[model samples]
Target chain A: MAFKTSVQKYTGSINKLEFGSGENSKALGGENVLPFYTFDGNIGGKPLIGLEILDVYPEKWLDELQQIYGDAANNAVQWARFVEEKFSPDFICLRLEGADPNGLNKSPEEAAALAKEVAQAIKVPLVVAGTQNHDKDTKLFEKVAEVLEGCNVILLSAVEDNYKKIGAAGVLAYRHKVAAESSVDINLAKQLNILLNQLGVKNEDIVMNVGCAAVGYGFEYVASTMDRIRLAALGQNDKSLQMPIITPVSFDTWSVKESVASVEDAPEWGSQVERGIAMEVSTAASVIAAGANAVILRHPGSAETVRKLADALINN
Target chain B: MERFMIIGERIHCISPVIRKAFAERDAAPILQRAKEQIDAGAAYLDLNIGPAERDGEEVMMWAVQLLQNEFNNIPLCLDTANKKAIEAGIKVYNRDRGKPIINSADAGPRIDMLDLAAANDAMVIALCAKEGIPRDTEERLTYCTEMLERGMALGIDPNDILFDPLFLVVKGMQEKAPEVMETIRLISEMGLKTNAGLSNVSNGAPKHVRPIIDSVFAAMAIQCGLTAAIVNPCDQRLMETIKTCDMIKGNILYADSYLEL
Candidate 1:
C-alpha cells in the first residue's frame, strides 16, 4: 500500500479576525486543521509575530534588549517606529507597563496619548497591552480605546475580572478587537469567551490569550491548555473557543531565569542575548505548535527566527 | 445529567491475534485486552465475535463466562450476527454491574433484536437506519421513530434503547456530518438516549489522523446531546478529548486530575 495521508474533516474553523484597518490591517485564524497541519487543510495565514514595545522607558530590561532598542527605548512612538522599520513585524504590541498603580502610576490620559502616538507612528496593526492590573487596566484601556477609536487597534485584553467595562467601552462602543485573557485553564478560557460573546462582542472582534508560562516554568500547563482549547474549537465545533489565540510570549519568556540570568549568575549559559533569544524562540515555537495563532515576542532576532519558522511551516 | 458512556471496541474478532485467541479459547489475549480497556476507564467492553455461525452459542457463552469470572462480572455488549449467540451470552451475563447490551438491531429485518432484548431483559443499540444508509435526517428519524415505537411496544425502557445515528465514514461522507449531528439532536430532543460506533467516522482515515477525527466528532456529537458511544478507549487522545468535553459540559466535576478519571 502506497502510504495515503489521512486528511481530517474539520467541521469548525477559527474565526478569521482582522485587527488593524486599511492597508496595514492583518488577520489570523480561519484555519480548519490544527496549527501547521497544512498537509490536512489550509493554515489560513502564517502565525503572526508582533514585536513588543513598552509605553515607558524600560528600566529593568536586560542589556541584550537594551542594545537592540538603544535610544528608541526612551519613547513609545520612537520605539514603535524603530521596531516597525527595523524588523517589519506583523504588528507592534505596546505594553503600558508605565500605567501600573504600583509603578510609575502614569495617568490613563498620558498612557492613552502615548497609545495614540504609537498608533499613528506605526504602519502595521497596533496591539495595546495593559498593565494587567484589573482596576487600572480597565480605566487605561477605556481611555486608549477612545483615543484610538477609528484606528481599529486591538486592546490586548479584556479579562474575566473586568470584561464588562472593557468589553463594552473598548470593544462594543469603540469598534476595536479585544483579546479575551484567561488563566492556564481551558474551562476558564471558554467561560471568559462566553462572557465576552454574551456582552455582544462578535467572534471576529475577539482573540484569546489563554495564558503563557516560559518554557520549563510550568509551561506544560500552557501547552496542554492551548491544545485543549484548539481541539475544542476545531474538533468540537466549540464557538466559544473558536477565536484565534494570541499569546504574549515575550512577557512570560523574558522574565524567566533561562532568559534573564547573567553570565556572573550562570557562566555556562553562554551569551545572555543568545540565551534570551533561545528562550523566546523555544517558547514561541512550543506555543505555536500547541496552537497559538499569533505570538508577541521581545527580541528582534527572536521575532525574525520565529517568523521564519512559521513561514517555512505554513507557507511551504 | 447523563454521563457519556465509552464502550471499549478492542476485543473484536477481526484481528488475527484475537481470531486465533477465540478459536483456541485462549484467555490471555482476550483477558489482556479487557484489562487494558477497563483500566483505561471503559464503561463497558464490546465482545465482537463476527458471524460465529458454526459454534456461535458455545463461543458466546464461554467468552462471556470467562470475562465475567475474571473481571468481576464486567458489563458487556454482545456483538454477533447470530441471534442465538447473543441469546447464549445473555443467559450467562451478570447484570449487577450493568444490564448486558444486545449489540444492535435496525428497523428492517433485524427489528426482532428489540424483541429479543425485551425478552432477555437487556439493553439494545438501535441503529437509526433500515436498508443501508438513510437518505437524510428525515429518513433517519423515521427509522428512529419506527424502532423507538417498536421497542416501546415491547415494554423496553427508552433509556435502555440507545439510538445510534450510524456514524458514516467522513472520507466519503463529509457533507453528511452535520446531518448525523442533527439526527442526534432530534433524537435527543425526543428525550431518548443515543450512542454511536464512533470509530466508523474515521474508518478509512490514516492511522495517525483517526484519533483526531474521532475525538473531534465525539465532542461535536456530545454537544448535540449524544449520551454514549462504542469507541477504542485505549486511544489516549480520544479519551482525553472525551474527558475534557465531559468536564466542559458539566457532566463530570472538574479537578486537577480530571484527565486521570
Candidate 2:
C-alpha cells in the first residue's frame, strides 16, 4: 500500500477580488494553498504590485525619490503618468494625504478632482487611499467614488468607526471595491469585514488591511497575523477572512528612520537609495510570503524588484 | 467552551440508510455520511448501532475497523446498549487519534460499563439516572455522584468520565425543561465536563420547529455551562447556532468566517 505524505486539508478557497472592467484588470486571493506552497494546492492568483502616487506633495521627500520624478513629483497627473510610462505597475494607489488635518488640508472636492485627473491619465485601476482621517476620508472617498464610477476604483479604507460610510460609497453608489482596515488586531480585521458584508458588499469586493509595519519594526507580527488570517479563511473556512489580504508598505516604510537615514548618517547600512528600496522590497516580500494578495509600495525601483520576486515565487 | 466537543450523531443505526448500509456492510453510504460530518467540524462520531443485540459484536467490530481504515484513526464513540458489542469495538479501536468512548454507563445496573471503560482506557458518558430521568437538579446530582464515584473507584481518570443529564422531550416535559439546564449547570460547576443528547429536547415537535428549538436550547445550555453535545452535525441551523453561541460567550475565538469553519 502506498501512503502519501500527510498534507494539510484546506476547506475554503480565497475569494478572488477583481478590479477594473476589461483588459489589464488585476486580481488576487484565489489560492487554495499557503502562499507559494503549490506542492500542496493551487495558487489561484499571483501577488501583484501597486505603485503609490500622492495627491499631496510632501515637503521633505527623500532626495533619491525626488531625483527619479523631479517635476512630475509636483503634479498628481504628471506623477501618475511618469510612473506608468516608466514602471508600468499593475495598478496605481493614489494616497489623499492633503486631506490630513496636519497636511495641506485640501477640501474633499479638490482631492476628488486630483483622483479623477490621475485615474483618467492612467489605464490601470486606481486605489484611492484616505488620509487616515475618518470624517475627511468619508467625504473625500465619496467624492472620488462618485467621480470615478466606472473605473472600478478601490477605496483605500473603511475602518470599524466608519465602514458604513466608505463601504456605502464604494459598493452602494459606485461599482468599486473597499479596503477594510483594522489595527494590527486580526479579530478587529474580521469584525470590519463583517460590518462591510452586512452593508451588502460582496466578500470578493473587499480587501483586508490587517495593518502593516516596516521590515525592522515588528515585521514578524504583521506577517504572522496575516498568515493566521489566511489559515483561518482557507484552512478553517472563515468566511469573514476569505477576502484578499492587502497591506500598505509605502507609507509605513518611507516614514521609518532606517529608510530615511543618509549614507553619511549610517554608511554601514548601505547607500540611502538602496537602503530605502531594500526597506520597501523586504517588507513587500514579508507580506507576500505571509499571504498578501495585494500590496501598495512607494518607489518605482522597489516595485520593479518586488514584481520580479512575486513572479518567481508564484512560479515556484 | 474554548473549543466545542461536537459528537456527530449521524451514524445512528435507526436511520433507514444507515440500517440498510449496516445490514449489507456497504461502506459507501457510511463513508459518505462520516465524511460529511467531519467536513462540518465534528470532533468525534457516536456510532449508535441501535439495539444491535444478536450480531452486535460482529457489526460493532466491522464498523470500528471500516471507519478507522477510511478516516485514519478517527476517534469514535461506541454507542450501544450491548456491552459486549462495545467491548468488541474497543478491541480493534485505534488509539492514535484518540481513545474510544463507551456510549454510556448509568447509575442503574448498566453501571458495569464503567468497568469496561476503565479496563480499556476509554472515556464514557455517565447518565444521571438509575431507572428514569431525574426530577430535579438535586436528584440528578445524586445519581451523577454515584456514577462518578463508581468510575473513580474503578481507576478511571476523572477527565475520562463525562456526565450527561438526560435531555427529555420538551413537547411533553414543558414543566421539566429548566431542570435539565440546572443539572448541566451543577455538573459543570463541579469542574466536570457536561454533555447532553441535545436533539431529545425537540422530540415529538413538528419537524420545522425542531431545529429552531434545538438551536435556541443549545445557546441556553451553553450559557448554563454545557461542554459537549451529541448532535446531528448535518443540521446546519443547529450547528451554526452552536458556533455563534460559542462566539457570543467569548469561549471560542470569534472570526467572521466562523460559520464557514
Candidate 3:
C-alpha cells in the first residue's frame, strides 16, 4: 500500500535494454516505470560501478584519491588489478588520459599496450576510455579496440567529431561495445548514437554517455536532459536513442575544485576526503537517479558507498 | 490517483459490419484490428456492442468470447446501452489481461451498476453527467463525490472508479472547453482519477485540426492530473503528443543516445 496505487499496476511492465555481451556485458537492470521510483515496485541489482584507471600518473589528483591509489595510479595494469581484487568493482574503466594533447600526449601504441594488459588482467568486463580530445580519442580507441578484441569490452567514447573511426573499430574489430558521449546537449547525445549505428554498430552494443558534470555546474540541466531522453526512449519508443547509459562520475568530479582544491581554498567545502567522496557520490547518484545504467568512479570507498545506496534504492 | 490507463477505442460493433462479423463468430476482421491497435500501444479495447436491442446479451457474449479467445485474453471494456449486455459480457470475460471494465455508471439510474461492479471485483467508469452535462466545475465535483461515496459503500477502492469528465466538443462549444478542463482539475484535486473520450473534445472540428486540439487538451489535462483516457490509437499524432508530454512532465527519463524505455 505504500506504493502509489496509480503506479502499482504498471510497475514491472517497463522494459530495460542491457548492453554488451559475454564476460563484460551489463544486465541493464531496474524497474518502476521510471528511475528511482522505489515506492512502486522491486528494484534489484546494484548500480554497476566502474573503477577508473588513469593512463598516466595522476600528478594532479585530489589528495584523497591519490592517497588510496599511490604508486598503482601510474600503472594501468596494476590499477586495474588492484581495483578488481581490492575494490572488487563490477567493472574497470581505463581512461587514456595521457594521450590527450592537453595532457601527457602519449602514443596510441602506449594506449593499446595498456588496454591489452588491462583487458587481459581484468576478470570482469573492461571499459576503455579515450583521452577527451575528440580526434585523438578516436585514434586511441581504435588501437585499444583491437587489443581488447573478443573480450566483450566497451569502448569509452565516440563523439560527434570522430565517431566513425571509433564506432567502426567497435563494430568491425571484436564486435565490442561503444559509448557515445555528447556535450550536455540532448539532441547531440541521440545524434551520436544514430551516427554510431550508421557506422554499423548494433543498438545493443551502444551505451549513452550523457556527459555528467559535478554538482552546481549545470547539474540539473544535465539531469533534466537525461530525463527527457529516457522518456523519449521508453514512452515514445524512439529506437534511435534506446540504449543503456554510462556516466563518467570520477572524471567529472576530478575536474571540480571541490574535489581537488585543498580545504583551505574554500573553508565551507568541508574535509577534502569527505568533500571528494561527496562530490563523486552526489554526481553519480544524480545520474543514477536520472536513470544511469552505469557510472565510473575513482575512489573505492566512494564507489562502495554509491553501490550500497544503489542496491538499497533498486531493491526497495 | 493511479497511473494513466489508455483505453483503446477501436474494435466496436457498429463499424461497418464489423460487429456483424464478430457476432457471427468470424474473427478475421476483429483479430486483425485487435493486433493493429495493440501493436500501436493500446492498453484495452473498448468493446461496444451498441444497442443490439433485440439480442444484446447474445452479441456481448459473442464479442467478448471471440476477442478474448483469439488475443490471449485481452482485457475489454463492455460498452453497451443495455446493462444486461454489459453484465453478460463481464460474466464470461477472462481475467488475465486485467479486470473487466464496465463502460459506465452515473449519478442516476446508472448508479445501480456500481453494486454489480463491486460484486465482481471489476473496475467501472463513472460518467459525471447525471441529469445532463454539468454546467460548471462544481457540478462535476458533486457528481464525482456522489459516485465516490456510492463506490465506497460497495467497498470499492477509489482508484478502481475512473471518472469521465465528459470532454466537450471544441468546434461549436469552444467556450465550454475550458470548463471541462476545470472539471478535470477539480476531480484530480479530490485525489481521484479521471479520463475522457478524447476524440469527443475535437468533434465537429476539421479533420487535421481535431487531433491537434485533442492532443493539446490531453496534455493540459494530464498536467492537471488526468490519469486515464479513451483514445484512438490510429491517431499517430495524438500518441506522439502524449509521449512528448510525458517526457516534458518528467514521467519518463531521457534515454541515452537512444530514448529511455
Measured against the true structure, the TM-scores of the candidates, in listed sequence, are: 0.61, 0.64, 0.71
Global Cα RMSD, each model: 19.6, 9.9, 6.2
Docking class of 3: incorrect
Per-residue C-alpha lDDT of model 1 across residues A1-316, encoded as one tens digit per residue: 8999889976678999998989889998989889899898877788999999998888898876888899999988999899999899999999999999999999999999989999998789999999989999999989999999988888888888899999999888999999999889887787787778778888788999999998999999999899878876777666778899999999998788887788889998888878888999999999999999999999889998998888887667
A88: Cα error in model 1, Å: 0.4
Give each prediction's DockQ, rounded to 2 decimals: 0.04, 0.17, 0.14
Runs in model 1 with CA error above 4 Å?
B1-261
- Model 1 error, position A312 (Å): 1.7
Per-candidate count of clashing residue pairs (backbone under 3 Å)? 0, 3, 24
DockQ of predicted candidate 3: 0.14
Kindly give the stretch of ten consecutive residues in candidate 2 chain A with the minimal lDDT sum.
A56-65
- Two-way lDDT contest, 1 vs 2, winner: 1
lDDT of 2 by residue, B25-44 (tens): 89899999999999898989
Fnat per candidate:
0.00, 0.26, 0.21
**lDDT per residue, candidate 3, A82-150, as tens digits?**
778888888888778888898778898887887888777778887888877888887788887787677
